[model samples]
Target: MIDNTSLAVVAPEILLLVMACVIALVDLGVKSRLRNLTYGLTLASLAAVAFLTGSEAATGETAYGFGRMVVSDSMGNWLKCFSTIAMMVCLVYGRPYAGDRDMLRGGELFTLAMLSLLGIFVMIGGHNFLVIYLGLELLTLCSYALVALRRDHTQATEAAMKYFVLGAMASGFLLYGLSMIYGATGSLDIATVFKVIAGGQVKHTVLVFGLVFIVAGLAFKLGAAPFHMWIPDVYQGAPTAVTIMLGTAPELAAFAIAIRLLVEGMLPLAIDWQQMLVVLAVSSLFVGNLAAIAQTNLKRMLAYSTIGQMGFVMLGLLSGVVNGDPVFARNAYSSAMFYIVTYVLTTLASFGVILLLAREGFESEEIADLAGLNQRSPLYAGVMAVTLFSLAGIPPLVGFYAKLAVLQALVVSGSPFYIGLAVFAVVMSLVAAFYYIRVVKVMYFDAPITATTVAAPAEVRVVLTINGALILLLGILPGGLMTLCAQAIVRMLSS
Candidate 1:
């Protein structure tokens, strides 16, 4: 029977579910070109969910519900809160772009986005392997629909097919790995699996075999190297609005599940998994940076850049355990958390500029499309430049501090090997800077293709400005967020 505590633990999720259904029905009657009613309802629901999750996170509470199949904890709640806000921002930036392209004729975009967010919430809260898998499927299915929303666009349909095929394979790999763990441990619950593995009765070889598949599946989801084949194609082919939806908030969910499966469930095998992460990280950095440098399409370049960024996130994850000691686990995971948060923040602004410049019947996707952007509108050009600089790890930017935090985590581990990894990451950052700065140079140095000033709605201008400001503000005062992440991770581990 569901008790008050269990119901309270899932209050936000329940509200989201009811509101998503209501919005879908309400959208059926939304005849406005912008679907103003649906959009407003969706934003209101997201804001309410964010508040609930933020309050729960602030309390630093951990509660289990649904027969311990799900957990409500500070780390999960905070991630959920951030994901909700990211979705809200994504919708705000995407609506205008979608409307211009006639992609907002119906309210499906708003409805699908909300469902996708609900799936993210479930994934973050899942404490059982089956529950997590279910959430993963839900999110992926909705994402596939969202990508294919523009029925007449061949590129959109093709991207959806590719995303669907690859996403299914990854889900299978994850499920098969989870089944293997269950076979070895006789339990599907994460806590029970942890106890079982820590007890050392399971066959090491069997567990390791399953781990290989699990990491591959996770690598695919995180857009890490060797498994990031679909990212660039999808990002380039899908509508810009869909791309933003796919890229931003889903990342936080991916990170949370990684923490759940690898850190919470299979941490006793740290030596084994950390070695795998090192290979993934190194390859992602090497391929992501070098490949990004060769790309002429702005979206594809950013896709490769994402792969490299995930490399740093992996560095933080792999550095958590040193010589079988988890003394640095909190610091390491928290750094990864902080890195992803800031990365998402910067990404919103970067893509917001791209979406803003893209007008009807024209896709502003190529690097040359941004020529003399500074001349067209200094405000947007400045925002884009700040975003690129932050991504390149320049000083006095949030990305720099994020990189610094992860590097500091590695160096503090006091391992020669980790220190070497830190050095390698720095070199990769330098390689990445070249491409990023090249974009800025194009914006400032190249002649304007058209002298018309870029125009955006007041809402977009306000949101983009606030987003860019946060990137700089957080860089200057990252301590609060850093401390929040550290506290959340500590609470998670202790519970």
Candidate 2:
């Protein structure tokens, strides 16, 4: 067995696990008035874990004797920080909503979210097939339960059912791919697998076939085109808080896993997978954006938009086009990571509004529902506009910065395809802007559907303030921020 002492590297994850269990036990007999206690415990532990991770040496090496099963790098560290912050925001937004409904949203939900975070950390660091599989399943299992957190809701039940049935099949596909990769390379470790492929001694067909399965499984996780059918339903059906977790946490996890496998394990075969990813990216972009255009439900629309965003992320990962420079890999990767962080925050803020809007019998799921919101409350309207503009990739927002980096990355190769894709992405951003701006327009320009609807809580308003400021701050002064992203990604890859 691996020596337990080596777990110091994973101290954050360990703390989170212990805290999760303790929270669950404490919550079992806790009084209703004290439900917020679980939130406190979770936040304290999460904050500690995040702080401890900052002290981890940036060795960029595999850990203990999982024998290439785990690795940690600056990339994982950065992503984890964002994921932890996002989950904490979810807890802050979830506390009142869960309590209002008398739901078991305290320790149980917190525990599961923490477990899912552990899986994400592992997924990001996996240096071997076994670790990746383990991380994937842990995340999946946690999500399936999370989807059904409101067990009484038929929509939640149905979504969970669909997620489980399809998720199991995807897991099976993942296993088959891993087995094939092992068969081709004679190893489950990523470094060894890469070495085997790099040597050109392995059978090409088996490696390629295995890659398809792995890519397909990842595609499902990311809710990419052709594999994204479940996303709309799941996002629409799950509790808004749960949807927030899924949208933000799982995407980061999936992005990390993709990078680990494609960039680290399968680097030698870039020519093979790059083309495939491009195709997937293009398809996802069109399908996701076009599908989103028709959806009236806010959550479902954002779900499709998330898929579209992933397509651009894939393009960034695959394009490797960096300005006029030939070496664009690191820039491209960093830009994608930055984009994911921004996306997660923008998404969380939107969902926070949804949670605040939701009551025992009503959920603010429709566009019309927010009509004249600006007239009623300029503050909410302003926050909503910030989110909408960010999503639309307008100037000065972090979203614009993300797209600019991607476009710059794609500009490296200077190919017609790259140019066309950049243009297409820009065009789609405009299209997306229409939908997002519509929300703002309705919120501000129209009359309120009801005068005495409900006022947003102080916490919700605070969430809006923080989220809006970040978006605008990054937009206005993106240079220093990009420098930090540059440092993080460069060190991550080089070390």
Top model number, lDDT = 1
Per-model TM-score, in order, reads 0.99, 0.95
Encode model 2's per-residue lDDT on 83-150: one tens digit a residue.
78788888788766776655564466888888998888778767788888898899899999998988
The TM-score between candidate 2 and the true structure equals 0.95
Candidate 1, residue 43: Cα displacement in angstroms equals: 0.9
- Write model 1 residue lDDT over 196-308, tens digit each, in one string: 99999999999999999899989999999899998999999999999988889899999999999999999999999999999999999999999999999999999999999
Model 1, 145: alpha-carbon shift in Å? 0.5
Model 2 misplaced stretches (Cα beyond 4 Å): 1-5, 57-65, 321-326, 453-457
User: Residue 351 error for model 1, in Å?
Assistant: 0.8
